[model samples]
Target chain A: MEQLEYEFDGAGSLRQSGPAVLVGVVSSGNLEVLVESAELGGRGRVVVNTSVRGFGEIWQAVLTDFAGRHNLANLLISINDAGATPAVVSLRLDQAAEEFYRGEP
Target chain B: MTTTSCGTAGQSYYEANALKRITSLLDPGSFHEIIRPEEKISSPHLRILGQPCSFNDGIIVGAGRLAGKKVLIAGQEGGFMGGAVGEVHGAKLTGLLQRATEEGPDGVLLLLESGGVRLHEANAGLIAVSEIIRSVLAARVAGVPVIGLIGGVYGCFGGMGIVARCCNALIISEEGRMGLSGPEVIETTMGVEEFDASDRALVWRTVGGKHRYLIGEVQRLVDDDVAAFRAAAIELLNDPRPLSLEELQKEHGMLSDRLKSCSSAYDAIDIWHTMGIAEPETLPLLDTAAFHKAVQHVYRGAA
Candidate 1:
């Protein structure tokens, strides 16, 4: 397993402060994303723990693209991946963000 | 969209994840998870073994309400490690049952979808399963009824099958299967000729919900829909069958009778035939309603 961490500047904070929103599941070729409000000093942080090794560069590119698309200020995005592709990772991240913004249980 | 108190119509419980099952089965907005995913409490042994870890250790546990009644609930994520029980996952379930004994909830609903103990952490997982069984019995002894719902993709097998049987009652769907040994494991251990794992029809007939309900192994058999499961759970909470010495004796007598009657039976069809069902071959093709109608006359109070 490889652990990857990335920090990005936030575009804005979340609309509502609520409990964490989780999306997806850690299965073969799938991943789980947990998005929660945290004290990150106005910056977004993502921690990825993946079973697929030697993908640090790809994770960086995908996380960078994700951070660029969403306003992740004061949010911590933790991912537990099991060989998910970049497209699935991106989709789960977006879904988690949507759930977080909607304040879903 | 027509939504009931539990969830929208036509939502398949077999496809839903652990959290989705819990939220959809319970009263809307009533599930408050004990250990949130953000807390990042996962299996400690997985990382060292080069395996990706789930945030909540593949099981979600917390307090919730079923049809306006207080209840404690737990759901196993079948997608994660086949919903196998490890140290943390088992502890969470044990803790919840212990809480149920103390707080004395209306009931404890267990959404069991596990294949069994995790082989990666073999000893710890096995020990955890034992502890969970004891805790479940303890809660039942304290007058807290424990109900199990088995309709997930992975089905319930291995140690979890024992756990499900220990519950006061079980609500299963056609897709849910409960057995001590899984088909694949049997095929691997005793050759495909002995138990063909690829034969889905044979596997279902042996351990699936329809057969289990007909044989009285499960209390209720409903459709695969989440709404159906929710309704069944609400109805069952009104009738909690706590364990008793008389119940055990009755169960033992039923088991002995079954062994004597079915010892020479070749397959589940033969068992069904012995149970006095005419045209037992047609059972597998029948829908849930038709299956119930066909077996209404047969004595199904035995295990």
Candidate 2:
């Protein structure tokens, strides 16, 4: 097997839009999320690069579900994943968004 | 804090500085640095990125005698661009500690001064932290002491915080701090009001020696003076039995109990008050002897 490495970026290009961006610190078993403002267009699109192959569709489904649920759009999200599970991924993403809007969560 | 007498002279990689501090209390000339920087074993990923390299990569590894006891020591030098570890840096560290399981150093002293992985060699640094965790588990399997010595400028953030937590024990200098996200990152991610990036007191309270010791995350506290560091190292290293699996299981159980009881708006001062320390306000100003004499660690069984 090749290096199980990956990177994903979602431009938060959706109809319900505001300015938010997410940049995650790449660490194994954990991650850091930065969500913030971005230029419009390329909205709601997510890009992923990983050593772990064949998980693109899984990510697409998860991210799409996430973006839709948050009603988040017009933002850029960049992640550096190190084999972290969907739960940790979700937690960090949620924290980033909450921190972004300074929302209590 | 009294300065420990240093017998070695050179451009001390923070790694060397760490070992020197420990050895100053040990017999002179008893220090034996293995897989040293002079070997020129470094990260190849940096070569790909056209970055300067370090011998032992940025990690310094070795085994030495302190107080007539043999121990293994490793330190990451943040001085070389904040002592970030790349692939090779990670590998050598993970591998040597793995070996320590069999060869067996009385204790593992980590001179931690890191901001996490080297972004230039991202994946490798990440991978190495994982492997090092595995080695920590191995050390646990064999019943050896594993420790984190946090004082260097990088202040042990990121995965290293978890790594420090994984230690069988811990030692911290007042100047050292440990946390997941750094201050700058906290500012960038959570905004200034959520956490002012420049407030030293806020930073220290969040992850500094006082907070860590109050929380029972740090086993012993010492001054930044190298001699104080050496004395602390010697004391912890002298412990014959480290935390056993049964003890760890119990501690884990206690942590669960703590989490269940205290998850809401708990402040650091709340801990000091609960632990029977006389005055939370004066704890910071107390000397090492006074601090040791006055306060009680709420969690007692980690070391």
Candidate 3:
């Protein structure tokens, strides 16, 4: 199979202020996340290690949109995707971000 | 089905390649590989695609001794399709837990490393993982300890990450990662300029093991070495309250608190600084021991 791995370093309060961190796995139509708080100074990051590569542009767009939409200035979001689609990924990222920040069960 | 490669997948073999800290966690030779690769547990769905099958369904299940107590162990073989869980693979895993419940194994140790369900056997794989989780919950109800170990490249992700979180206990090494969605998809839906999925430091800061431990999501954070993991598993097995209700509540509360704490905006470093931890810049870079000793945890004691 094809696998790709990389780490993303985001900027500003978007990186550190997030008392929450979201970790997840990417599969088509679905995703899982581990959202917890961090100590990094709000410069949160999103590391992507996936089996489906050659789509760096798409990934950047999705993450940037989520950060701006939710104002995720403090958390780092990490993920690994096999072949999950855009909708599934966004839902999970938002859910994870919400879980970490909102404290919803 | 390439039986030749199966034999090399023995516990010792896995032990050898396994993260260095995880070694010696279970009893010396108690590992009993179920659905052994040699058994040729291939994904039934693959036959339709004219693809060769694999033994153990890419998942190795069986019993092993963690210290002196008997512990059921299941590990994913990532070499096969990124170690996704397929129908047969999922069944074997569930079956192992089912049998463990029936026979009353001393404890259950899941050497979990998966990318969730196998697309080829989508529905079956999904059901298998779901059932497997139910079975593990059953084991927990029956007083059998369940330890979910995440210390590999694929790690506990997708639906499986939920399973891992639902388990009685969780252990994560640096090499392992758990999340719901990958960045590319998020970027596509949310926009590349918004998420910037290519940033490495950004990712690790959010979902990496250290933060999970800090927020008390992960019970233990050890070195990536297999031996350390093995030791932790062994220690957990010997304890009477290997997986206690009190601990689960604490974890659940952490989740709840996080959900409640969110506003329109949030970030990792701000969380840390607010928690009163100093010099936040290199926090994620700190090793397990260093972080544990250095950072001041926001949540003290258990729930």
Error at B33, model 2, angstroms: 2.4
DockQ of each: 0.93, 0.01, 0.02
Q: Where in model 1 is the C-alpha error above 4 Å?
A: A12-16, B1-7
Candidate 2: stretches off by over 4 Å: A1-105, B1-19, B22-26, B240-243, B274-278, B297-303
TM-score on B-chain, cand. 1: 0.97
Report model 1's chain A TM-score. 0.93
Show where candidate 3 strays beyond 4 Å. A1-105, B1-25, B240-251, B262-265, B296-303
lDDT of 1 by residue, A47-103 (tens): 998888899999999998988888889888899999999999999998888878877
Scored by TM-score, the top model is: 1
lDDT of each: 0.90, 0.64, 0.63
Report the lDDT tens digits of candidate 2 across residue range B1-303.
Answer: 123343433222233444345455345777666764324465677656544444345566777776677878787766554667678877777877887898887877777888877778777778888888889878867877887788776789887777888887777876788888888889999899778879877787777876777666777777666566666778877764555667788778868865755565356666666656667767777776777666644436343
lDDT of 3 by residue, B1-303 (tens): 142354222323222322111224555545555553323346668767544344345566777676677777777765556678888877877887888778787788777776788878878888888898898888877788788887766556777777787677777876566666545546778897766668877666666666666666666777776666766776666663544667677668877876665442256676677667887777877877877777745545222
Using Cα atoms with residue i matched to residue i, what is each candidate's TM-score against the true structure?
0.96, 0.66, 0.66
Q: Write the per-residue lDDT of candidate 3 for residues A32-83, one digit (tens) a residue.
A: 3444445555545566544455777787788778766665444545454556
Once model 2 is optimally superposed onto the true structure by TM-score, how far is the C-alpha of residue A37 displaced, in angstroms?
56
Q: Rank the candidates by TM-score, best first.
A: 1, 2, 3
